[model samples]
Target chain A: MERLMKIDRRLLYLISVALVAVTIFMPLGLPVKVSPLAVQTYDAIQNLPDNSVVLIAPMYDPGAAGELNPMLKAMLYQCMERGYKIILGNTNWTLGVAIAHDMITPIAAEFNYVYGTDYIEFGSKPGGSVWMQSAQTDLAGAAIVDFNNDPIGQFPLIQAVPRLTQEYIAAVLVLDCGTPGAVEWLQIITQGTSIKLIVGEIQMSVPDSMTYVQSGQYNGMIAGSRGGAEYEQLVGRPGAALKSQDTMSVIALMVALFIVLGNIGYVTRKR
Target chain B: MMWLLAQEQAPVPTLGIFSAGSVIDFAIVLGLGVIIWVMVARARTGRKIPEIKKIAGLEAVDEAIGRATEMGRPVVFIPGILSVDNPQTLAAFGMVSHIARQCARYDTRFLALNCDPLPYAVIEEITRQAYLEEGRPDAFNPDDIRFLSAEQFAFTGAVIGIFERERPAANIMIGAFYAEAMMLAETGSFQGMIQIGGTAMTAQLPFFVAACDYSLIGEEIYAASAYLSKEPVMYGTVVAQDWLKIVLALIIVVGAVLATVSPDSTVLRDILGGY
Candidate 1:
């Protein structure tokens, strides 16, 4: 019993891994409601005039893949369905190419949304906020080229599309897992522009982003996995995000309950 | 009519209990709340405890603030990038208040750079109260509490600029930080400011630890306000948090034992597994 109480972290980690594996395989078909933020984001995409220009800032890395990817997929689906053109760019240097080359390609193919017509991914731009301000002023000049060194302008989609300023951008969808992401859009462009902005932020950033939502600076914000699940509900379809909600709820309740019971045990023993 | 229709379509979300695993969670929450109430009652009845373990990151506040005061430099407090509603940020602001009072008592200036507008308003009041508490309400400079642009890197860039221009002696960054965590701490390091960083950002903890002179990890960030303020309610909360930790430890132990002893036991797993 004493040994169990002081079990090493590696063993604990292994057990946790096993638990996660088991849970993933065992689906509970959990019920989820759409968040206002996700619905607003979906509506913004759904309501956009077909062939409208959307700039997606996928500013995150692999660590946040589990949280942000579902929202990205849903957004892509909506854009393709609505016939809006998307310009995919990254603020994070490392994850930018992977997102452009690996994630978006097959998904776009599934929708038969041909490259250079429906979407154009202009790989990663390294400069953080400075890059955002530059992007607002000059899009082609800012992102410069595609995943291939080929000029972004060479692509039929790129050549035809005007540069992204307040005038050209229909909406800015930011999937952010870290700082310097949505804040870049909020500060650099959205403050004075007519371009609508929505953020898909991780759970931790929810409270902070809510202040932005309250201030009316951001159109809407989808927070963490829960927000993504909620967005799925609003779309009248369910995906991985919906299933993940139960897992999250279960985990949160587990932790909260354990904390409560532990105090009771301690107090009772003392008495 | 639209409002009524919208309400009809909207399903009320289940507030609690979605799966069998939820049973454990409900039990835990209920148990902990009861324990906290009992503990507070006992304390009120005058049961004094021994000195608790020291948190080194906490002890350095006086040194950090004193150094800033001695150098006739302002103590720059980044109350976090998040708003006042976040429990972590709110707690961090409480500690910032104590530090601000120290700065006032020493006749040193206090500078707070904020990101969110709402929290900026709340923190402005916190700074004001600190100066008033120190009997130097006149020293409180509302402008010193600035609403930097709310964008993440934009705010970070501004903070970087503040460090360059003001050259504050101590940089106390206590809140929920992310990638910009390193950017802020590294900038402070370049300026030769004694940097102290604290957050519940588990992934970003390593960056702060590497760059900062002192770093508060995990629950320590939550405990900071209580430790600094010495208020009874805050102390009571820490006691609650401690009880929570012990319960968590026990759950993990029991869970490990059950899995090892009977890997194939559905009943045991049900008793343990979440929804």
Candidate 2:
């Protein structure tokens, strides 16, 4: 019992790593139970009028990519499937541009989404909330060029949505991880309006964001990676998030086992 | 008949002197300002102000600096990964000045690392001013104040490298931190440094509490400078904040009762709900 209590920390680290590797390679395919919030999020997107335009703002950088990227991918899948015109962009998160473009381009191609018609990428702008305010009034003026640095005027899709108002855009689906994110959108653009604001938040920020959902400030929310996995299932596209569900379940179990084992060792040692 | 018809056609007179929606907001601001002014005036008149409760994290600032001085190791201060536009970062500036002044007095090396260029310039200026004010201007080194990186994890990596190389005896983190908060606090703990952290980011507070020697939670960071300086005028502001909080608490309780009594009542809703 004393030996068990005094097991080397390095050995514990090794066992955790080995478990993660096994789960990643040979997924147990654990079922992800969809929550009410994820269902509401899906329904919000699904119920948009046909051919409506949505502003997909990936307002996060590479640090939050692990969680938010999957959410963005799943959202894009849903938006494309619903035949909605999409505008992908962010502010002060330049790194997210490449990540979003890579994910969007391939997915758009699958849906036969024409670049200048069905979807467009504004890439990253400089100002944070200020940019959000500007885009609300004049999106083209705020974002002069596309991801390729070409004039936005050349794209018909960009011309269709002159501003980020309810008249021009149906909804704003924001993947938020930090400041000047979903909150900024709500404050600057969508507060007291009919423009739907749906957010995909990191697990850490879910509790903070739930209030907005409850207050009807946010039309809906995709809570975290679990929310992403559930949403992927709803969209009938089981992607990275669904695949990682098993790994998450296994890792959770491993952590539980460690806690119980450590407590047992302590009890035995005291006796 | 003609008089009654004209009366019905005429627009009703506008209520109050101020704009319909702005009166309450204006009054609240005016009330807070008056309270702060009155308290400050009272404090300036040499009246004994009520003592503020001891904040453990702030009290540890001096001990951390002294330890670094005795060990002949640098004291590192990270003012968070945000621009000075944030109130949290501004509050962090007040802390940095206080810490830097103490370090100057102790003849200890102080390093200020930043992730934003705008705050980097401000921090460098603040540190230089602190040293100058302490009559140790020569101790201020431009190289010690560095802008690590705007990227979150990149900044964390650079800070970890600095921690390994310098082996600082104290790590003071104040301001708005996000995902990198845990990584930085854990690294400081691993380096065996006395860590004092303060941030308004509630999500990251748990990590700081877990890893730091002392952590300031929420509004404590804002009150830190006032507490440390012990200035009557600053204390007045803190007192005013407490009073305002009490007023808000009363309003919340009253509002809850009213809401329960009359579910259809929009009185409280209209007053507090809209911006």
Candidate 3:
């Protein structure tokens, strides 16, 4: 009982690593059920007026790539399928835009979306929330150049939406991880505007983001990896998030078992 | 009639200083400043003010350091992973000073680990000052104040490696933390070290609360410096911030109720939105 109570953490780590490896190689294909939130998120994007422009900000870096990357890809696919004019970018997190740019290239090509007309990548801007404030007032002045460093004034999509406002933008989908992210967008551009704010959060930030969703400040939210898988299912395109559901479930169950074992050992020993 | 009238008179937003919408934000900040000034005047005159409530996590700092001293093991302090500009990192400075002073008095090994280079420079000097103030300048080892890494995981990896090697008796983590909170807290727990963690980061709070012996949540971290030092002026500043929170909370509740009762009303929304 004492041994169980104080089980070597290294042994537990080894077991967890091995389990993760095994599950990845041979997935259980655990079914991912689409939740109401996922449905609402899908509807929020799908129900945007035909050919409306939307900006999707991937506000995270490589540390968060495992969870947020799939959310970004799924959202991009949905927007492209609906023939919405997509504006992709972020601020402060430079790598996020670069990572997202690579993901969108092949998908945009698949949808026959033109580079400057149908979609545009602003890459990663500087100044975090300050950049958001600038973009809200004057999109072209704030961005100045596209992902390729080409002059944005020459682009038709940039000319169509002069600023980030309800008059031009239909929705703002944010793959949020930390500060100067979804909250900044909500505070700066989207709140009290007709332009809907939808966010995709990493598991760590889901609790904090939920308040906005509950308060109706955020129109929709894709919760986490579980939410990501469910969203992928809704989009009818299964990706990394969908495939990783089995590993997540197994890990969760393993953790729960460990907790139970430790508690039982402690309780019995107390007697 | 109102809806039709609004559509016809769709107001063009003005680009100006002191716009009607921004007044509320400005007013609140100005109010906080006024409150702070008043409190400071009162504190200087030895006027009565509400006592800062005891924070158990902060109160445990001295005991945790003493345990390390008695056990002849190092005390590890990680002042989060952010630069000095962050409010949380600034809040951590006083607590680190108190810890370093206590360690200097007890002649215990003190390790001040940093993730950001800017804070590393600041914290190193702060630790040195603490030792100097304790009249133990010779005991202060410059090597103990190490800048681990600027990268998040790299810093975390380095801290864990240190924990394994040094086997510190106490771990004090305060300031802004992200994903590394759990990794560090759990490692400390397994080592059976007395752990105290504080951060305003909502996402990382649960990990600290669940794993650490003592956890400071949200504003408690902001109040730590004032409470630990019991400096009246600092207390006044923290109290002013608290008053502002209360005022903001009231506004939020009233706004929520107004919006709920009358869905069509944008009076409060427009003002608060700063549009």
Candidate 4:
């Protein structure tokens, strides 16, 4: 029992990895309980005014891609289904726009969405939140060119949405994992504006993002991967996230079991 | 629908007196300043101020250092992975100063590791100053105050390597941390180090609390310098912050009640959003 408290960390890591691998092959088929927050997030995006222009910012790097990719896909599917004109991009996360671009192109094609008129991708920009500040006034000036390096002023969507304001964009959907993310979006473009801010946050960041949700800074939030799965279900697109629920459940139970074992050992040893 | 026709970057709407969003922030800052000033005045006049609750993480600093000294092992301080511009990293300077002075007095090895070069440069001078103040400038080793890497994972790897090699008895980490918090804290735990962790980053706080023996949460790290130095003037400021927090809490409660009673009303939101 005392040895349980001193379980070598390498062994613990090995067991966790092995468990994850086993679940990948033979799924546990656990039911994922959808939280109220996920429902709120779905409704927030779903209930937007017909043909509303939405800006989606993938505010993360490759490191967070595994968790956030499904979220971005589900969001695009929902938007495209609603026939909303989409503006895809971000600032500071250089690699993020490319990832989002790949995900959006296929989804847009499936929806028969036309480029330049129906959607435009402004690849990543520099200057973090200051870029967002510039975007509020002049969209074309802030984003000089489209993701293809062509002049954005030619696009009808760009012409319709001259600035990032409530008058133009109805909502800003942000998939965030760190600084200069959804928080920056709220502070810069949305804050008191009628433009609603909705966020998809990583699991680690849900606690911090929930504050904004409660304060009505973020109109709604998808809490994490579980939230992503719930959102995918709501969007009627059961992608990779919904399929990976079994693995997550098994990993969660493994962690809990280890905690109980360690605590029992400590308690017994102390006595 | 207000058409934002002004194509160029429009200045924040100044309804003549002040900009729209600045109203609440301006009022809060002014009120906080006046209150803090009064508290400082009271302290100077030898009047009583409410004592801040003791923080276990900070109190254990000396014990951790003493343990390191007895074991003849190094005491490693990580000021987090962020630059000095972050307020949390600035807060870490105070702890580093105190810890460095203690290490100097006891002639124990002190190693300060940083992910960002700016904090690394700043912490070097801070450690040197601590040693100088303690009349042991000769004991300070500039080489130990190292800038490992700027990349997040790279820095985590380098720090983990240091732990394996140095075998530090005490590991004190305080500042703005991200995902790297867990890896660093867990490694320290594995080495049987007396660990003290702190950060204002709520996301990273759980990792620190889970892995570190002692953890300082949010505002506690901000109030650390005041707690360590025991200066009356600093105590006054901390108490004033508490007073202001109480006032804010009341406002939130009142706002919630008003919002619930009149769901359609934007009265509170408009006033707070503006003047």
TM-score of each: 0.53, 0.89, 0.88, 0.89
Second chain TM-score, each model: 0.87, 0.87, 0.87, 0.89
What local lDDT score does residue A194 receive in model 4, on the 0 to 100 scale? Answer: 75
As for lDDT, the candidate ahead, 2 or 3, is 3
- List, residue by residue over B6-42, the lDDT tens digit for candidate 4: 2234446666677457777888899999988988888
Per-candidate DockQ vs. reference: 0.03, 0.15, 0.33, 0.25
DockQ order of candidates, top first: 3, 4, 2, 1
Q: Model 4 lDDT vs. the true structure?
A: 0.88
Cα RMSD, each candidate? 17.5, 6.1, 4.3, 3.5
Query: Residue-wise lDDT of candidate 2 within A15-131, one digit each (tens)?
Result: 889988998888777779998888999999999877788889999888789888888998999999888988999998888888999899899889999997888999999999899
Candidate scoring better on DockQ of 1 and 3: 3
Candidate 1 residues B137-201, lDDT tens each? 99898999999997778899999999999899998988887668988998898799998988887
Q: Which regions of candidate 4 fall more than 4 Å away from where they truly are? A: A8-11, A33-35, A151-154, B1-14, B40-53, B230-236, B252-275
- Looking at model 1, residue B51 earns an lDDT score of 28
lDDT digits (tens) for residues A1-271 of candidate 3: 8667889888999999998999999888888889999999999999987777899999999988999999999999999999898999998888999899899999999999999889999889898878988998899999999999999989988888787877778889999988678998998888667789999999988888899998889999999999999999999999999999999999999999999999999899999
Predictions in order: lDDT: 0.75, 0.86, 0.88, 0.88
Q: Which structure among the candidates has the greatest DockQ?
A: 3
Tens digit of per-residue lDDT, candidate 3, span B148-196:
9987899999999999999999999999999899999999998999999
- Clash pairs for candidate 2: none
Q: Which of 2 and 3 is ahead in TM-score?
A: 2
